[model samples]
Target: MTLFAVDIGGTKIAAGRVTEQGDLDGPVLTTTTPATQGPEAVLDAVAALVRQLDDRGVTAAGVSSAGVIDSSTGTVLGSTTSISGWAGTPLSHHLSQAIGCPVFALGDGHAFALGEAVYGAARSATSLLVLAVGTGVGGSYVRDRKTLTGSHWAGGHFGHLAVPQAEGLLCDCGKVGHLEAIGSGPGMLRWYYRHGGDPRLLDARELFTTADADVTAAHAIDMGAAAVGTAAGGLVNAFDPDVVVIAGGLSQAGPRWEQPLRASFTRTLIPALSGTPLIISETDAWLVLRGAAFYAQTRKDIA
Candidate 1:
C-alpha cells in the first residue's frame, strides 16, 4: 500500500513515500512551490518529486492541494492567489501522465479531515467535523472513514459561512461577516490592528504572548474564538454531527483559545446537542499529508 503522497501549498511542496502502516517510509523531500511561476512550473516540481522514487515500488499517487479541487476530475476549480495560474489546471492528468500511475487530488481541508479521522483526534468517531482555523479557515466532514466532498468539490470550505452577530469585517472572498473574516488568524490580527493595538505586535505568536497584558490582543483572540464557536453552532445544526475536531495554527493559543471557544460553543448549542465532543488536534500539516497518501492508495477508482 505504499504510495507517493504530495502536499502542495503556497510556500512549499512536500512529498514522500507512504508506508502500509500509516507512516512516511523515508525522508520527506521538500522544495519551494514556485507557485507564481505558473501551473506548468508547479507541475514540473511535482513531476520531479515523483521521479525521485524510481525504485520505491509505489503504484499510486495522491495530492493534497490548497484550493477548491474537483477531486474526481483532478482539476483545480478555484484557488487562492497564493498559487498563480493554478485554477482550471489538469493537475491529476498531468501528474498521472508523468508518474505513470493513478493520481487522486483532494482539497487540503478534506485531506486533513480524513487523516484525522483515521489517525488523529477523530479516529474513534464515525462522523466528525475537522475544522481548521488558521490564516484561513477551512473544514471537512468525515463519515465512516470517508470524506464528503459535496457535488462541486467545495463541500469542506466552511470559512465563508456568515456569522450574523459579527460585524465590520471582510473576507478575502469579498463577503462581510463571514466566519473566515472574523475567525481566521489574519482576521484576528486585523481585529487587533483595527482596534488600536500596538503596531509592534504583528503575528499571532506575538499577540498571544502578550495576551494577558494587552487588552486589544486578548480581545482579538476572544473575538476569533467567539466567531468559531458561533460558526460551529451553525455547522452542527446543519450537519448534526456529534464530534468536531479543531486543528490549525490558532489552536496553538492553548488554554486562552480553548476556554473561550468551549464556553461559547457550549452556550450556543441547543439542549439536544449538549456535551458533544469537541477535540483539538495537534497543529501539524503532516497529518493531512498522510491522508493524501492514504486516499491515493485506498480510493477504489484509483486502485
Candidate 2:
C-alpha cells in the first residue's frame, strides 16, 4: 500500500510519498508553517499539504512533529514557543479526519532516531542514541527499532539536560544551564557575540563559516561542540547504546565542530563505554520521512 510521510517543524511543513520499502518516493513538497495562527490553522495547513500529495492509493500517513507527542493518541502534550498554540493538539485525529486516511504521529526526535536505526547511519546497530543539533538539540534512544519514550513522552529531550558549559545562560524553556543554551546553533552564535566576536557575523551558519579565520568564532564553535559531546558521553555511560548518531544541521558544520565534540565525548566516557562508535547522519529529510512511514505501517491497528 502507498503511505504518506509528513514532518512538521516551526519553520516548515513537508510531505512526500513513502514507498513500501520504507524509502521516500520522488521529491518532497514543502511550505511554510503558519505557526502563529494557532493549532487549528496549523493542522489545516498540514491537511492541505497532505491533500496535495494524496493519490487514491494512500492508506495512511505518518507524521513526525516537533513537540512532546503521545503517539498512541496522536496528541501534542507540550511544545515550545516556536509554534504558538501547538500544545494539546490532536494531530492524528485531526489530520485523519481531514484527509480520510489513518494518521499516526510521533515526536520528531523519536522518529529521527527510528529512521537512523532502521536505514541511516546506525542501521547496523542493535541499539543507539541520537543527538540532533540544529536550531536546538533533540535526541532519542532506540532499541530494536523501538524508541524509549518516557512516561510523559518527553524522552530524548537532551537539550534540557543541565551542563556546566551553559551555566549562567538562560534556556528557551526558562531553565538555566541547559544543554540547548550552549550547544544549539543559536546558542553558539550567542556565545560568539557575548565573547566579543565580530558583530558582522550573523546567524550560526555564518558564524560556523567564519570560524576558519576568526579565533573567537572558532572558540564558540568548539565550546558548543564540546558541550554536546560532554552530554553524549554521559548519556552513553547511562544507556550503553552500541552506537551514538549525530544528526541535524550542526552535524554538517564540518570537522571544526566535530573534532572538539569527539574529544570531549571521548574524555567524558568511562572505561567500559570508551569504545562506543559515534556516527554522523548522511541522509537528510528522507530519514524522518522513512521513519514516519515505518510508524504508520507498524501501527496499522489505529487505522
Candidate 3:
C-alpha cells in the first residue's frame, strides 16, 4: 500500500510518497509556501501537487500543518498571521474536495512525535516528548503509542509555558516571558541583540558561529542553552516521559549548545527523572514529513 504525505510549514510545503514501513518512495516534492497568499492559494498549491501524483496513480493524502488543527474535523483552527487566510479554515474537507481523496490532518509537532515513536529516536518508548525548536518551539507528548490531544487539542503546547525572564521578551503569540520568547532561535537572537550583541548576527547559525570565536556571542549561546535546559527539565518532571527527542535546525549547533543544555537540565531535574535519556534526532529536516507518512500508513482507512 502507498500513502501520500504533505508537510506544510511557514516557509515551505513538502510532499512525499511512502510505504507501510516508513520508507519514502520516489523523490520528495518541494515548493515555497506562500505566506502572503490566502488559504485558497495554499489549497490550490496542494491540490496541484496532488494532481501531479494522481496522474502517477497516487490517491490518499495526509497533511501535517504548522498550526492549531482540529484533527477530528480536519480544520486549521489558527495559524500565524504571516500565512494569510488560514484561521478557522476547514482544510481537510477543502483538500478532500479539491484533490478528490480522503484526507487526514495532524499538527506538525504531533506528526513528528508519531514519526519518532514509530520509526526514529523513540521507537522503543511508549511515553515520549518530542521538541522541534527552530523558528519557534513545537512540542508533542505521546503516551502508550498514542498522541495526546487534550481538551481543545492543546495538550502539548510546551512553548507557551511561561519562562522566568524579564518582562520585555516578546513571543510570536504576543506574550512576554514565554518559552518561545527565550529559547526559540529568533527569541535567542532577539535576546542577544537586547543584551548589546551585534544585530548583524541575525540568526541562530550566525550567532553560534560568532560564539565559537567571540566571548559575547558565547555568552548568548550559554544563556539560550540554559533557558532551553530549564524548560526541558520542567517537561521531564511534569510528563516523566521515557525519552525526550530534540529535532530542529537549532539543535544542529552540536556541543556548542548541547553541553550547557544538558548541564542546565541536570541541575533542574529531580534526581529520579534526571537519568531519563535525551536523544537528538539526526534527520531533523525530514522527521515531520516521515511522521506524516507514518500517520497516513497507519490510518489508511481515514485516507
Candidate 4:
C-alpha cells in the first residue's frame, strides 16, 4: 500500500510517500515547524505539506512527532519547551480531518525503532532496542516487529532514566539527574562548559571534533557516552532485547563516543547479556517516514 508519512520535529516537518516495500515512493518534502506558533499552526503546516504530496493513490498518513504521545488516541500527552503548547494536542484527529485521510501518530522514538525494525539495521532481529541521542536521548523497544508503547504511551523514554553520572543536573522535564542531562548532545556540551572547556564553543560538534586533542572535550565525551551506555546496559538487563541500535546526531561522533559507550555498556551488562550487539542505525533520512507509514498501515483499526 502507498501511504503518506510526516515527521514533525522541533526544527522541521518532513513528509513523503511511503511504499509497503519499506522505501519512499518519491522525494521527501520539508518545511519549518511552526512550533512557537502553537499546535494549530504546527498542524496546519503539516497538513499543508502532506497536501502537497497528496495524490489519489495515497491511502492514509502516518505522523512521527516529538513528545510523550498517546498513540492509541494520537494525542501529545507531554512535551518539552522545544515546541510551545504542544502537549495535549489531538494530533491524529486534527491531521486526519485536515488532510482528509486516516492518520496514525506516535512519538519519534517509537517511530525510529519501528523504522529500524522494518527496514534498517535491525530488520533481521526479532527484538530491538533503539536509542536516538540528539537534542535529547529518545528510545524505544520493538519486539517481534511491534513497538512497545507503554500504558501512557511514554514507553522507551530512555533519556529520563536516572543515572549517577547525571546526578544534580536538571533535565528538560524539570526533573533532576535524568540521563538526558548528561547523555544527549546538548547535555555533553553543557558538561564541557561546566568543566573548563573553551567558553566560545557553542556547538557540540566543535567539541567532538577536537576531542582527540582536547582533554576537556575527551572527558565530556567519555562521560556522556558512559552515562548512556550504563543506562542502555541496565535496560538490556531488564528487557533482554536481541539487539540495541543507536541513532540520532550523536551516533555520528565516531569512535570517541562509540568506544566509551560500548565499554561502559559491556562493563555494566551481566555476562549473559554481554553478547547483545549495540550498533548504529544503518538508515537515515527516511527512517522515521517509513516507520510512520508502517504504523498507519498496521494500526488502522485504532478508534
Each prediction's total of clashing residue pairs, residues at least 3 apart in sequence or on different chains, is: 0, 0, 0, 0
TM-score of each: 0.95, 0.97, 0.94, 0.97
Which of 1 and 3 is ahead in lDDT? 1
For residue 249, give model 3's deviation from the true position in Å. Answer: 0.7
Could you give candidate 2's per-residue lDDT for residues 1-303 as a string of tens digits? 878999999999989999778877767899899999999988988888877875657888889998899998999999768799899899999898998888999999988888888888779899999999999999799998899999999999999998888999999999899999989999998999999998887799998778779999999988899999999999999999999999999998789899999999999999998999998889576788888888888888445
Between candidates 3 and 4, the TM-score winner: 4
lDDT agreement with native, every candidate = 0.84, 0.89, 0.79, 0.89
**Superposed model 4: Cα runs more than 4 Å off:** 301-303
- Model 1, 138-183: lDDT tens digits are 9788898788989888897788888853576888888788888868
- Give candidate 3's total backbone clashes: 0
Candidate 4 vs. true structure, TM-score: 0.97
What's the true lDDT of residue 289 in model 1? Answer: 79
Model 2 / residue 73 / CA error / Å = 0.7
Give the TM-score ranking, best first. Answer: 2, 4, 1, 3
User: What value does the lDDT take at residue 245 in candidate 2?
Assistant: 95
Superposition error at 215 for model 3 (Å): 2.0
What local lDDT does model 3 show for residue 44?
A: 86
